[model samples]
Target: MTPSNILSVEAYFDLICPWCLIGKRHLETAIDLLARERPDVTVQLEWRSYPLIPATPPDGIPYRDFYVARLGSPQAVAVRQAQVIAAAREAGLTLALDRIETFPNTMLAHRLVRFVRTQDGAAAAATLVDNLFTRYFMRGANIGDGHVLREALAECGIQSPLEQGASVQHDMDWLPPLNGPDDPPPRAGLGVPHFIFNGTHSVSGSRPPEALLEAMLRALARAKQIATRAVA
Candidate 1:
């Protein structure tokens, strides 16, 4: 089997999830590694929306208590926060948990992402996704609000209405074919930081860049084998 160009990676994530942002950073690093190691392979990164707190209001829920309740106790949440901070540090990112006040419904943001992708392309969508995460996690902006979504898009050079025509409803009506019927379920259930490589292999969670890089290479090899078989 001979490896070729055009390796596609699709990521399912939520802007509100700190771990998801960490995953983004890790994936970015892995892509850089891919570029250096396999110059012939073109890595196509596609972002998919997977809202974590979809039912929260546009304004949002209180940040601290939301985690306290979700993780069982203040101590548990503190531990989680500490863990996130440590992981974020490795990826050269900060969670800024203290400044954040909202646990927002991210449907509007997803709509904006789709609109940007429709108008511009995958690169634009990736930029918007990064902005959404930065606005939510670093600067503590409420991404659920239409205004904030618009601001993020503006930062990304994508001009679009955040709310006027966009539905606040669930945006994932048509899912990407990252997984197929013949293959085993890649996950136990839906989880953010789900990464599928070349539409043939996948790995979930905010794994380190090394693991992701390995997965990407493996997917490429599998793709090459399949391509060779087809030709033969």
Candidate 2:
């Protein structure tokens, strides 16, 4: 397919969400599978912003309390968390549930991702996601902390823009315009980890690699049909 007819997917998510991380891993597997199946198909990925706890303080809150509050019943919450841990392990990811001390604001991390998107593209954003997940879920680091963020970014080969804030902004346009109360959310009527395929269809949550590949193929077909109709 031509570059114009290629499929594009924009994934909206936050680093704090375990399901989001699982979804990302599945998506990566799907991409690899698709590349092998259809060498002609080109997929463009864009990572968009979705903060799970926008109101979360910079210092963060204890994970146990957070889950108990959100899930209501302590027993049910434990069961659900166990499932998440197992799922993460199955996906070749280590999730240390007990070690997580706090859940912090992901706004700045999202901003950092947006910045990385401008400078190094989607791959960089993916790396940031992976790093943040590992840090928070496995290493039990406070992601909302600037020091931790800087360290993670450096590990991912992304220079800390905050250190040299002014120069970095000029070079990468890292500063995003503030969204007012009236401003709409990133994607219209879409939830966390929502994947918009080639501006045609939307897929939400963590889906199997087979499902993702099917959606990608459908998106590619849709693009071709649109191109043909335009010519006619």
Best by lDDT: 1
Estimate the overall C-alpha local distance difference test score of candidate 2: 0.78
Which parts of model 1 are misplaced by more than 4 Å? 1-3, 162-188
Q: Residue 221 in model 2: shift from native, Å?
A: 0.6
Each candidate: what lDDT? 0.79, 0.78
TM-score of each: 0.86, 0.87
Residue-level lDDT of model 1, residues 87-162, one tens digit each, is 8998899778888888887776776676677678999999988888888888988887766765676678776543
Q: Model 1: how far is 111 from its true place, Å?
A: 1.2
- Candidate 2: tens digits of C-alpha lDDT, residues 129-209: 889888988898888777787788779888655666444223435555323343236745557777888878877888877
Model 2 TM-score on a 0 to 1 scale: 0.87
Residue 69, model 2: Cα distance from true site in angstroms: 1.6
lDDT, candidate 1, at 122: 91
Model 1 local distance difference test score: 0.79
Instruction: Report the error of model 2 at residue 97, Å.
Output: 1.3
RMSD of 2: 3.9
